[model samples]
Target: MNAQAKPSLLAKFGDRYAVDPNKMFETLKATAFKQRDGSAPSNEQMMALLVVADQYRLNPFTREIYAFPDKQNGIVPVVGVDGWSRIINGHPEFDGMEFRYSDALVTPPGASAPSHEWVECVMYRKDRGRPIVVREYLDEVYRAPFKEGMKGPWQTHTKRFLRHKAMIQCARLAFGFVGIFDEDEAGRIAEQSERDMGAAQVVREQAKALPACPEEQIEKYAAVVESGQRPAEQIISMLQTRYELTPGQRSALLEVATTQGDQA
Candidate 1:
C-alpha cells in the first residue's frame, strides 16, 4: 500500500481553520494583506502568516491577525484590537481586568486633542492571584495625526487610545506575549525597517562606486585586522575612507578579526 500523501503547508493550515486553503489564501491576499507597495504576498510570506496564526489561534478571516510586508522580504505579524481582546481573554490564566483614569487632562503643543494625564490597567491572573498594574501616560504613548489638520483615531479618540495602550502594555507584562505587535507598533517598525533598508542600499551603491583597494595596501590592512587592536567596524571605516573593499576582502578581514582574539 502507498503511504498517505503529505499535506501542503496551505492544506494543513486550511485544515486547522476548517477552510479551503486555496480560497482562504486568495481571500487573505485580497482582504487582509494589502501591502503598502501594492505587491502580492509571496507563498513563503503566506506560510509564515499561517504559522503565526496557528501559533496564536487567531482567525484571519475575522481580521484577528494580519501582516505587512517588511524589509528583507519578510512579514511583520500585526494583531488587531479584536485579536488582542481574544488573546487576553482566551488565555487560560487570565481572570479579569480593570482600568483607572487620571483626573487631569493636558494637550501637548501642536496636538489637536487634549488627552488624560494617564490611564492605568490592572490585570488579574488565575494562577498568580495578584493584579499586574501598568500605567500608560497619554503624552508618552500618544501618536499625532500623520498630516497637519488631519484627525486620526489618536486625535479623535484620545482617551480610548490611552486605555488601549495601557491594556496592551499590561497584557505584555502579564502574559509575556512576544513576536507580535499591534497595528501602531507594527507600522512604526515597518517604517523604520524600510528606512534602514533604504540606507543600506544607498551605502551598498556608494561602496560599489568607490575605486578598488590598491593591492600594495592589502598586507598592511590584513595585519591591522588580524592584530585585534581596534574594532573591526572602525578599521573598515578607516579603509573605506580611501578605497573600496570587495565582499571577499571584507569577509576575510572580519574572519581574521574574530579569530585572532586576545592572543593577537
Candidate 2:
C-alpha cells in the first residue's frame, strides 16, 4: 500500500485508505442484508458502511462493524465490541485500557430498575498526557422503553454492554473517527439520563418534541427583561393561558424566559 494511494475496499486494509464503493456494495450483497425477497440494504446504508469501514480500517465480513437493519432507516453502523477494541488497541500510541462497574440495582421483581453503577472505560494513549475516559449506565445506552420481544441489555448483559458503551466512547475520542454516530446516542441525547422523560414533572412531552426555541426568541426574551417590563412570569402565564401551550411549549417558553432573566 502506497502512502499516497487510497486503499481499495476489496483489497486488504493498509495505510491511507478510502472506500472502494463498488466493492463494498458487492460485499453487502452476500450478507443477510441481501433480502431473500430480492430486496437489499439501501445504497445510502451500504455507502455509509463502506466509508466507515474504510476510515476505521474495519472489515464488515469479520464483524468489526455492521449496520443493524432493525433500527430506523437501518443506516446506523453499530461497531462490534471488537471494533472498539481494534480501533483503541490498533492506534500507534496506544497504551492500555481499564473498566469498572457499580453494584447492580436492587429493584423488586419485574420493576423498572437501573444498573447498580455506571460503567467506566478509560483508554490511555502514549502521546496524550492523560487517558480518555467515558462512563455510562445501562439507562444511558438504551432510552426507548425496553420492548417486550427484544432482549434488554439490562437483563441479558447490562454490565457487558455498558462496558462496551464506555469503550466505544473512549475509542471515538481517541481516534476522532466520527463518520458514524454511536447508536447509543442516536435515539436521544442525555446530559442526565436517570430521569423518566415520560413524566410531566421531568419535562412536558410536547416540549420535548419542539426544537430549541430559536435564537431570535431568546434574544427577544432577553430584551424584554432588559426593559423591565412584562416579567418572565407574566409572559409565561400568557403563553400558557392564551396559546394553551402544551407542556413542551410551556417548558420551552419558560427556559427562554429563565435564560434571558439570568443574564439581566
Candidate 3:
C-alpha cells in the first residue's frame, strides 16, 4: 500500500494495544504525587503514554507540566509521533539506535491530557549540557515511511519495530491511569459474567438474608469476615453498645459473612 493508504502501524498489533483510561489517570496521579526530590522518568514515561494513545487511536491533549529555567529556551511539553520518536531514539533521524524508557517520576503540569500527563525534559547538547532549541519536524521533512526507498539500514528497521512493540505494551499499562476498562460497560459485563456462572444470584440472596441475625453474633461474624480473625469476647461485647439484632438475623449475617470470607 502507498504510505498515505497504509493502515496505521499500531492497528496491526491487535486490540490489546488499547488502554483503560481511568487506570492510566490513576498511575499518572500516583507518579506525579511521589516525592519530588528524586529524578523524574520524563521521556520514558511520556513515550509510554503516547504509545498507548496511538494504539487506541486516542488523541491526548498536551499540557506543559514544567519548563526548566523557564520556557524561553528550555524544553517544553510537546506531543505527536515525532516527539515520541525523538525521546525514544535520542536522535531526530532514524539512526539505527535502540532506547528504553526510564523509571523516573516527574512533577506534573508538565503535560497532561484529559486522560494522561507528562513532565517536560530540557534538550541539551551532549558535550556541554547547553540547552538546544526544540523544534517540531514537519510531516514531509520526516519522510513518509516506506516512501522513496527511504527505509533505514537493516539494523534500524529491526530496532524500530522492537521499540514500537515495547511502546505499545507500556502504553497499554499506562492507559489504566485513565479508566479505560473501569467504566459501567466493563462493570456490567463483569456482572453478567458472574450471573452466567450462577455466582451473582447466590451473593445477592446471601446479602438479603443477613439482616435477621443477632447484633453480637453479627458483629463477631462481620469481624471475622472482614479481617480473617475471630472476634475476641471483648470485641463481641462491644457490639451491644450500638444497635440491636434478632437471632435469625444473626444466623443470616453469619452465612453472609462466611460466604464473603470464602470469596476472599
Predicted model with the maximum lDDT: 1
Clashing pairs in 2: 103-116, 206-248, 207-248
Q: What are the per-residue Cα lDDT tens digits for candidate 2 across 1-264?
A: 657874454454322235464554665656723543466777666666777787788767677776654322355566666776777678898899898776766332233455545778888888999988888765555443356555554455555656777877777787686755454553333322324433554456554554544446545654675466767667656444334444664565567667766887
Instruction: Flag the better candidate by lDDT, 1 or 2.
Output: 1
Q: How should the candidates be ordered by TM-score, best one leading?
A: 1, 2, 3
TM-score of 3: 0.18
TM-score of each: 0.71, 0.55, 0.18
Better-scoring candidate (TM-score), 1 or 2: 1
| Candidate 2 vs. true structure, TM-score | 0.55
Clashes of each: 0, 3, 34
Per-residue CA lDDT of candidate 1, range 149-259, in tens? 777878777888788889988999999988888888887787899899899999888877889987666667778777656766777778887788878777777777777
Give all candidates' CA lDDT scores: 0.82, 0.61, 0.37
lDDT of 1 at 189: 84
Q: What lDDT does model 2 reach?
A: 0.61
Which residue segments of model 3 deviate by more than 4 Å?
Answer: 1-167, 172-201, 210-244, 247-264
Candidate 2 global Cα RMSD: 10.8
Model 3 Cα shift for residue 12 (angstroms): 25
Better of 1 and 3 by TM-score: 1
